[model samples]
Target: MGSVIEREHSATGSMALGQWAVIGMCMLFNMINGLDTLATAFVLSSLSAEWALNGFQQGILLSASLIGMASGSTFAAPMADRHGRRPLLLASLLLSGTTMLLSFWAQGPWSLALLRALTGIGVGATLVGANVLTYEHASLRRRGLAISLQSVAFALGVSLGGLLAHALNETVGWRYVFLAGGSFTLAAGLTGALWLRESFEFLAVKSLPAQQADHRPALSNVATNSPVPSLASQRLFGRGYRQHFSTRQWRETISLATAFFLVMFCFYFVVSWTPTLLVQTGASETHGIKGGMLLNTGGMLGALLLGLGANRYGSRQLLLGFLLLNAVLMTLMVPATQVLSLAIGMGFTLGLLLNGAIAGLYILAPQIYGTGERASGVGLVLGLGRLGSILSPVVAGVLLDAHWSSQALFTFYASSLLLAALAIAWGRGGTEERAGRSRN
Candidate 1:
């Protein structure tokens, strides 16, 4: 009996060893996910010209995608909680990739917008599933590091998309970009279908004792602190649990949501209008695209460095520090333009910090909730954040239409970063310890 137990432990250890490999594979999926999310930004100008779109139309397109993304976030979290993580993720990847591939065939702006919105749904769902998978598999000490690595993967994808678009858009055409980007998602989906395993925790929940007489599983494997109420019994607002968004939880959620709004607002604005900004500053479309690529590269580097810092200082300090740096870099966007290298360098710095801060939010959010409520909490926060994403492009369009100077654009972005800094400060308290306890 003792030897049998020892053997089981050995097998568990071996299984864990394979998790690192799985994590690496998941990173590829993360990259593909980022590509799908940001590809629209790269092609916005081309689409505007080809379709003869106005600022309002652009805003509508951006908002449409964001609304779909929010729908995914709102639904997928509960699904992941009730179902399992791996299955939902696999489905998300396939659906998202297929939708993006279909976008290439759209005949008009409305069709393209619909397809893009569907793609956003896939992207949004996949983001939550992937983050949960990676974070849950990680040790408490390394949780922040794991999340940071995912951010790096995302930044790398977006950066590469920018660079690739700059180099190939003239030769291959914009539709090809969509096709190529979509292909990555297809590859990731196939890989996941072939290699991904159900999470052990999720499996343990499902494998709970069966009813011998009925020959069926007795209870659902989904985690929850409260009793499993019927669909009609479940209530989000009523006194369902001991703590329904206590003061601390509400503050944490609000702070994170606000930070997400500001960061996303700036991020989408840059993604949608970088090319236009470059042109306004007297650069070619190619130069503008390259600058976008440079910014992403900077972001990737920042995520890598911040991942290391997360292991040392915890995600909280790292987030605050990064937010401050991002504010400074964003404010300097106009002045740094005189020297192209300075502009690129500054953009890179901003990207790094931006990616890290956002990643910090993902890492810390799960720590704040119990196992049962985790998915719902994460879902709600991300859903609200999508509202920010929805607003960002619209705001950018309005500013562009107002004939705002390039300097004014940078200045506006700077204010968002400053607000993020404040939110980060407000959210401080017990996050690292909470994360550690969740792992135990």
Candidate 2:
């Protein structure tokens, strides 16, 4: 009886620790992955003024990173399945940190763009690795919840970048902002190295079921739907996944990718170019930047609340509500800028609704595919989404180049969210399959 009780207690402890480790590590990685990237955007005005860059040039600089992200995201998932999650994630984090440090050495727009591209590559790799690992680590009962927490990390990192850039730009210089963010990534990576263990599922891929049957009896019950392939070729493009790479899958990928693309285009446009937009609207640099940073804070709030809420109520409804709310708040941003409180409130609400809803898309993408094709399915979705993000800056720059009114810009943003809502609403026809392996 004592032995049974002790075994039960050990099992409970392991379960709790696994949940915390997976969620907490992924969140921290999310924070590090985007911190320097976001800070660069906040400091772009200063860089432009220092270098005499036009709006189009600035947009090109922004596009450089997305270009790398698009490429990197395409390959990251396959490598994660091919090798394993932890090593690749660690490498991505290291690359992100190193690339951030290199940004300090950039002398002009072209150089900065090159460095930014490298940073984007690192972010793409990290994102793919992080999401796949989080899904592998989480209990089936709470997989959605674990995945959504990554959105919280994204908001936190963005907010931190904005605040840090705003606070330090006046005193330490914009380069210092990159350095600080980079240092944080290095530190976080080191901590992760010490604490993070390989996911049990990844280990299971290498072990025979019979060999795992004695002391590791728990491994015997791993769900077949979880795709425990020992080889990458067996999992991604395997016989079981031929349908996933077929015409039907391509159609689904395109539809969802386009909707996600629209959403991200709006999101990145607001995030990457908002400071420029606000400054163009006759707000002083200080007020414009302060307002821009507020959006990230709002994003963090929305992601945390809606992400957890979706776990209870369902991702579909949460996504619809958040997108509709985003449309409403974005429409208000044009007039609300006249009042400080109202403008900040609108920015916050917009961030929360927009990012939180997008987070659900990330969770849903993997679910839409069978276990055998999970990595490829997610990679394609995010790759297409990055293309949307890539185009956002150019589109916004064109509007600004043509002297579009702030109201007009905001209107475009609002309409995009509405379009995204319509797409999601009309395209909700798929069945979801459970992943095969549980993290524990």
Candidate 3:
């Protein structure tokens, strides 16, 4: 009896520690991902001057990383479902870090784009892998908060990157920024390899029924001895793509992807060009960096607030409200950009609402697919969604070259946000809350 009680206590301790470990480590990974991914944006001003780049060329440079991100999300992220999240995450981190370091040596636009693209792929894969890992570990009731924390960490990293560039670019030049970011990322990869563990759900799914039966006697002493209930009984990917999901599932997935695409399009446009746009409006390079930092700082706060309220108020309702607010903010940003103070304030607000709404979408994502296909499902959506990111910068470049005002561009994107909210409203509701309640 004493031994049984000890075993039960050990099991409980392991379970609690495992959850914390996954969340804490994944959050760290996401922070690094954000820092490395946004480093280029932070340094783009210096790079543009150095290369004597045209507007179209600048847009291409910004879009190159995003294009790589799209490919990584579609192809590399899904590998987590088969190989396990930890391994894929480590590999991506290493790849990203290596490429970022290599980018420091880039002599021209072509070489720089190539390196940035490779780094983006790594960052993209890491993003998807970390999300899936965190979601699987978090209880349903706290999933929103957990994912929000990840977003908060990411935003914090972006803010830090901007600040670092602002402080160091003049003193050290842009090359050192990549050097620092790459070194930190490689360190993060090592930390993950040492400390991270495979998702329990993935482990259970991989364990054979016969093997489980053989282990039952050993696990029976614990009060909660059963394996985590599998979200789907179907084989991973099944016989074919069509056989894996029903028509309803497909529709829901497509709707989520559409919403993701639209929001990301708007988000990346602001992120990629806000600094340059600020410069065009007569702000110093320092002020431009400050503007970017303010946007991310607001994003962190917005994500925290949304996470706290989402469970109580309902994810869908919060999402809609946030998106609506984002549209209003984006429209207002037109006139706000004319004044330095106003632009800073508006940029923060825009980041808060826009990023907060996106966080809500991340909370809703894992609910749409079963465990068997969750990684692939999320990856595919994010990958396809990156198309919007890839195009937004290039499109914005063309328009800017044609002498389009920032006011007109933001207003157009604001309309797109409304359309995205409508698309999300038309989709299926999340089952995660219900699942969490049932499990409790």
Candidate 1 residues lying further than 4 Å off, grouped into runs, are 1-15, 44-55, 162-173, 204-248, 272-279, 282-286, 400-405, 428-431, 434-440
Global fold similarity of model 3 (TM-score): 0.84
TM-score of each: 0.81, 0.81, 0.84
Candidate scoring better on lDDT of 2 and 3: 3
Candidate 3 lDDT tens digits, 1-440:
23435433543344366677778898888888777877877788999999898876776777778888888888888778778888989999999999989988999988988998999999889988988888777654566788899999888777677677667788999898888889989999999999888766565555546445334322211222222223333245433355224664776787788889999989988876777778888999989978887887889998999999977887778999999988988888767778989888988888898899889888877667655566777888888888988777767778888998888889888887998899888886565544444567
- lDDT: worst 10-residue window of model 3: 217-226
Per residue, candidate 1 scores C-alpha lDDT tens digits across 189-215 of 899898887555444434544332123
RMSD (CA, Å), candidate 2 to true, equals 5.3
- Positional deviation of residue 150's Cα in model 2 after best superposition, in angstroms: 1.6
Model 2: colliding residue pairs: 225-436, 226-436
The top-ranked prediction according to TM-score is 3
* Cα deviation of 176, candidate 2, in Å: 3.2
> What Cα-based lDDT does every candidate model obtain?
0.69, 0.69, 0.78
Best candidate according to lDDT: 3
- The C-alpha stretches of model 2 lying farther than 4 A from their native spots are 1-15, 49-56, 166-168, 205-234, 237-244, 272-285, 338-340, 370-372, 401-404, 426-440
Stronger candidate by TM-score (1 vs 3):
3
